[model samples]
Structures are given as C-alpha cells and as structure tokens.
Target: MTTPAPEFNKKLGFINAFTAATLMGFVGFFARHIDAQGDFIAFSRMMCGAILFFGILAYKGRIKELLAYKLSIPMILSGFFMGNCLSAYITATQHTSIANAVFFIYIGPIISTLLAVIFLKEKMKPATWFALVAVFIGMMMISGLMSVGPNGLSFGMEFSQETFFGDMMGLYSGVGYGLFLFLGRYRTEVPGDVRAFWNFVFALAGITILFIFTKPTISQMTSTDWMWWIGIGIVCGFGALGTCTIATRHLKAAEFACVSYWECVVAALFVGLLFYGEPLSSGQMIGGALIIIGGMSEVVISMLGKSLKKTDKQADAMGAL
Candidate 1:
C-alpha cells in the first residue's frame, strides 16, 4: 500500500548522501591530529555518538523503543565487525599514507555490490561492470602497485612490508563496512536512527571491553589533548550519526557504497591542504577521478530509472482517476 517516494524525497536523499560523504572525510583529519590515541579517538567517538543519539531518543520519549526492538545476535555481530573496521582503518592511516588508507577503504562498495549480486540475487548493470574495472584500475594507481604517476605507468614488484600491512588493514575495513551495509540493508528492520544508535552503543561497549586488554597510555595525555578528544568526539560523533542514518535511508546499499567513495576524496583534500599544504600527485588525481566516476555512474543511471518509473506511475494514476 505504500506509494513510491516522491521525486523530491529522492533528490533530498541525494543531498543527504553527498553531505554525509563530504563530512566523513574529516575522520582522517581527526585521527591525524586528535590528542588522544587512535583507539581512544575511535572509542570516544562511538561513545559520544551513542550518548547523543540515545539522548535524542529519550527526548522523544522513545527510550523504551530500544529495548522493545528485539536485538538479534547477527545484528550484534555486525556491530562488532564495524568496530574492528573503524579501528583498523584509523590505525592504517598511522602506518601508511592517507592516500593508501583511504583508497583501500573505499573498496567497500565493490564488496557490497558483489554481495548484492550473489546473496540478494540482484543483477549487475553494464555500468556496474565498468565501475568495477574503473575502481580496480584506480585503486592500483593510488597504491603504487601500478603507478600512473608522471614517472609513467609502471608495474613494480616492490611492496613495503609496513605499507602492505596497512593496506591489508584498510582492505579489512572495506570488508567490515560492506558487512555493516549488508546488515543494515537486508537484515535490520529498525528505524534508521534507532539502528544507528545501537550500532554505536554496541561499538562503544566492545571498545571499552577491548581497552582493558590493550593497556593504553591514556594517563599521559595533557589538557590540550583532552580538548582535542572532546572536539573530535563531538565532530565525528554527530557526523557518524547524521551521515549513516541519512545514507542508509534513501539509497540502496550499493548506492551507499558508491557515495562512500567521497570519503577518500574528502580525506585527501583536507589532509593535503591542512597538514602538508602540498598538491595531490597526478596518480591520486587520476585515481580519484576514476573512483568518483565509478561511484556515481550507477547512481546517476538509477536516478534516471526512478524518474521514468515515477512518470509512468503518474500516467497510470491519472487514467485511474
């Protein structure tokens, strides 16, 4: 009995998707500059986000909604993987270049798209194949596995052990992100805000418990560090809340995957301008371009399809009336 969402809703969804993608880029900057250690940053951000989101639920007199929704083990398991992904991706930046970390992490969409085809029985469009190819070629360029820099494209067997490890962590991040999306898309029936709240709550709980094992140097931080932690917690905390909720609502999982590619672009731009004050290299520029193209090509095509469907629906409705 539900009518198709209006074109206006779809357009608003796109705006939300774009804004979320853009804001998530700041995560790298936070990880780079926050006074607290990376693990603390991850822990604090999730904790802060959960508190804020739950507070809103309480304000709405929906605190009981959380307990009312029956939580499944798979859903909880999804949160565990998500926490690991967040920590690994942040830590990868410490071990490798932001370019490598961000690019590798953005591969989530490819994983999600493949899963959709296999598990959801979704068919791949022509654009999807092209996007896959573009994503692979672009990722290669960014990783220096197949350099397309000014030195000209070269295939090198060289791989730094440190960078290789970082890349693996980033790849794991993509897998984690993909799994999170799959859960949100196919498994959870909870409202977007509610799901987001629980995801962070679970993530926070996991981190707190995990912290007991790590013996972190939290005691050494200064007041200046505390301010950075608070700032990062507030910024990324709310950013995660808003973006994750918005992106999941209007877009398909694959579409969300595509939009997430912006996170890398945002990271590269902010990090380069703020930290290095250096221009992006030719390879990064090209790889980024291809990633953007691969990411959005399907989305654009999907929008056109939606518009046509809406027009057809309008015609049928007019005839019925």
Candidate 2:
C-alpha cells in the first residue's frame, strides 16, 4: 500500500514557506564562494540532493511510494522547469551583476500569477493584484533600476551590451521558475519527498547531458568547496525545496505568492553586508519594507477571509439549531 500523505496545516505551511524562501537567498553565497563553474555547482547540488532524498525514501521504507507514483504531465513539466530554473539561476549569478540577476529572477511570481489565472482559472482578487504590484516595485528598487541619488530618485537603467546574455539567462530562470510553481500547484497529491526526489533526479540527469555539448572546463574544487556543496545540498536543495513543495500543497496561490519574495530581501542583505561591505541603500531598505508589507497583507487578507467564513458557518449552524 502507498504511504498516505500528511494532512496540511496552515501554520506549519506558512513556517515552512518562509524557511524555504529564506534558504533560497543563500544561493549567491555559494556561487560567490565556490570555485567551480555554475553547471558543475548545479550538478553537485543536484547529485548530492538526489542521493540524500533517495536515502530518505529508502530509510523510511517509502521507496515504494516514489516508484508507484504516476508521472503526470504536470509533474514532468514541473521537474523539467525546476531543473532549468536552478541551473540558469546559478549561472546568471556568475555572469551578470547580482542585482540584475536577482531582479530578473524575482519576477517569477508575476509569471506564476499569470499562469495560474490563465490555466487554473484562479480568481485574481484585488488583494492579489496589489501584492503583485508591490512586489514588482520592491524588486525594481532593490535591483537598483530606480536608485535614490543625492539629488533625488532616479529612473532608467543604463543598459550595457556586456551583460545581455546573463540578463536573458536570468529572465529565462524567472520564466522557468514560474512554470515550475504553476505545475507544482497541481501535483498536490504527490508526497513532498517523492516530488523532491524526482526533481533532483531529473535535474542531475539533464545537466549531465548538457555538459556533453558545452564541455566547459570545470575548475578543481577544494575540500572546502566539496564541504559547501554537501551542506548546501542538504540545506538549500533538500530543506528549501522540500518545504517549498509542502508550502505549495498547503498555501493557495494568492496567499503565498508575495510571501516568497522574502528571498529578495534576504539575498540583498547577505550579498551587500557580508561579501561586498556595502551598506543597505535607502532604496533597498524601502524596497525591503514594501516586500514585507506586501507579503503580510496577503497573509492577513487570507486569514481574515477564512475567519469570516468560519464565523458565518457558526452563525448558520446556530440559526438551524
């Protein structure tokens, strides 16, 4: 018999969702520190993650569930897009300015929203629209597209031909991520472990194949690099993605969309303060504020809606009695 899936709890879901987003921000830390090429880093992360998740399934005697689970179209696509999203994102970090890469990839929620509306026919509530717009503005400000200068606020990105390829890769990562999230919403029945296991497996396989054509030189990694890869695999790959999959199972599209932008704030903080010695700018700080507010607004709206509906049910029951 297949192992039964766990029941969803809103509180646990929200906590896991937040943790997952926060962990995602650490990707740049690894990209900056590790000596390997992005593809190699991606491959290491996926291979190690696949091993860890596989071990988890085997140890728990849930390997049967993984094998027995049907591979639906949505599940397959989710895995494919997820593989590409991680690969492209890490590569983008290496090539482009981190701010540019972060900005482009963070548009994921917008793409996710559009797909959800079109395919799933999810209702776009007013609050959802506001949240999306706020997140967009927050990302732009944090990305330095709109900087506050000595004179005042300045608008317009001075486009450079140099970063074009990296910029496109970053955008592609966002689109791929959006597709991944959309497809994830439909595969709610799949156990998080099973889904994560397949994600790592597919990503590992896909990257290995791509390496054949590119044949880029992978620099020799130090013992420290291997150590980071292992830890990141367990933490960022397994912990982050596992919780994210769980969050998708529990949180509705409108509820968790803004909340996931925690990645932007955390990423900016880690890169700016720790590595670059750059202090938070007025725009980044304000952008961080907008992200927090936008995310909180959606969560509060969802909670209020739920509470009102619950009270209405209680009132109806009392009237019937």
Candidate 3:
C-alpha cells in the first residue's frame, strides 16, 4: 500500500487519536461499576481484545502479519507497558475517584514527551507546548488538585491510607503508559491491525504471567459482568488500540501526546453524566473545557500557520513576477 502524504497522514492520525481516546473513556464505566478486581478487569480486556484482533486479522487475510511480526525488546516492552498501565489504572479506579485516576494516568504524556526528546529526538512546536500546559493545568483542576493539601505547594495531591495504594498505582500507570507510547514508534511500519494484534497478545501474555505468580480467587461473574466485559474489550481494547495504532503510526509520540488528553476529558464527562455522584466541582467543568480546547488548539494553529506561510510565499512570487 502506498503511504499517505506526510501532512495528510498527520491530520488523519490526530483525528483518529482523538476518536480512539474518546472511545477509551468508556472503560471507566466498566471499571467503576464492575465488581471484579483490577487483575480480572485487565485480564478480560486483553484476552478478549486479542481474540477479536486475531479473528479480524484472519478474516482480512492478514494473519501473516501477526506471524511475521518480529519480537524485539521494544515490541515486548511496549506490550508489557500497556499491560501494566491498564491493570494499574483500573485498580486505581477500583478505589479512587475516576477524575483522580484519569488525572494521574494522563501524566503519561509528560513522560512520553520527555522520552521523545531524549530517545526519539523529537521536538515540539511552541503551540503544542502551550496546549500541553493548558491541558495539564486543566487536568489538575479536574482532579481537585486546586484544593490545598498537606503541602503548601499547588500539587494538591495528598494521600490517605485508603487511597494511597490506588493513587500509587495510577502514578505508576503513567510511567508504564509513557513507555508504551515511546515504544509504539518502533512498530509504525506494521499495519495498524497487525500492530494492535501484537499489542493485545503481548499484553494478555504479560498479565497472565503476573496472575500465575499471584493467584487470585475468582468471583462469580454475573451475566451482566460478562456482557460488560466483552463490550469493554471490543470498544476500549480492540477499538481504542486499533485507532491508537493509526495515530501513533503517523505522529511522533510527543506530537500526539498532548492531544491524547481527550481521553481524560471524555472520562470525566462519563463520570459527571453517568455517575453524577462522583465528587465534582465547577473546577472540573473548566478543566474539561480546557482539555478539549487544548487538544484542538494545536491542530488549528498548525493549519493556520501553514496557510499563512503559503499565502506569504504566493505574495512574494506574485511581486517577483
């Protein structure tokens, strides 16, 4: 298949990333309402996602891509990182508020941006930097970090015994997901479906290995649980990751990381609209707006800049003529 033009590919990536992130937000619903532990939640998502991806690949007659996929340190680590982050984030939601969990998880972009600079040797535009700052502040507001905590600093993050473990898990998820994004850059040459297939397979494998060591007893899964679990797997796991593959393929990790905040904003919305009882304040509303604006602002600015530059060049050419 012929590659798309660089400019068009970037736009396509951005749009798909936005959609994927929005779809990913629904996982919070399952995380919040499901009675299962984080292990089970993660296991179900990865397992079902892998099956679905495999089936699709087989149907599309692209299963050879899966077999042709070479496992390297980067590939293995990327999948493992995804497994770690998904499990940790779900675990955080099991104990803490969804907003707080999302806030912590969104920090992955920060780490991803940094890794992009160091290893990927990528640079961000001034507009992107501004959007990132705006989104991050908004995330903090949504997470209630606007309130004063034990520290005089504005971090507003305070830990209690009940939420300490969950909060830590969220924070670690940020790190794991950061690595996942950075590693995704390596798999861009592969087909989007193939990339997603490997991601689910490796993530499921990692989680399974973890379960082997720390065996947890299973609880009875109601029919409702089964339905929700499969739905989450298809939507948030297969759908989200498939779209994410398209995004990461065309855009650098840092370039798309800021826009990924759409996930947090959408997740917050689900909490507000669905579970209205989740602790909320006016600050959350403002934060949600900021995140949406920040996510879009970069794209607008980039397009506008290109237009202006083209116009200027045209004017100069006409004057010369």
lDDT of each residue in 95-200, candidate 3, tens digit only: 7765567777888888888888888788788878888898888778766776433664255566678888888888888898888888888756677677777777
How does candidate 1 score on lDDT? Answer: 0.69
* Runs with alpha carbons beyond 4 Å of true place in candidate 3: 1-8, 95-100, 147-155, 160-164, 274-280, 303-321
Work out the TM-score per prediction: 0.84, 0.89, 0.85
Report every candidate's CA lDDT. 0.69, 0.77, 0.77
lDDT assessment of candidate 3: 0.77
Q: Report the lDDT of model 3 for residue 161.
A: 87
Better of 1 and 3 by TM-score: 3
User: Alpha-carbon error at 46 in model 1, in Å?
Assistant: 0.4
List per-candidate RMSD values in Å.
Answer: 3.6, 2.8, 4.0
The best candidate by TM-score is: 2
Error of 2 at 152 (Å): 4.9
Model 3 alpha-carbon miss at residue 38, Å: 1.3
What TM-score does candidate 2 get on C-alpha atoms?
Answer: 0.89
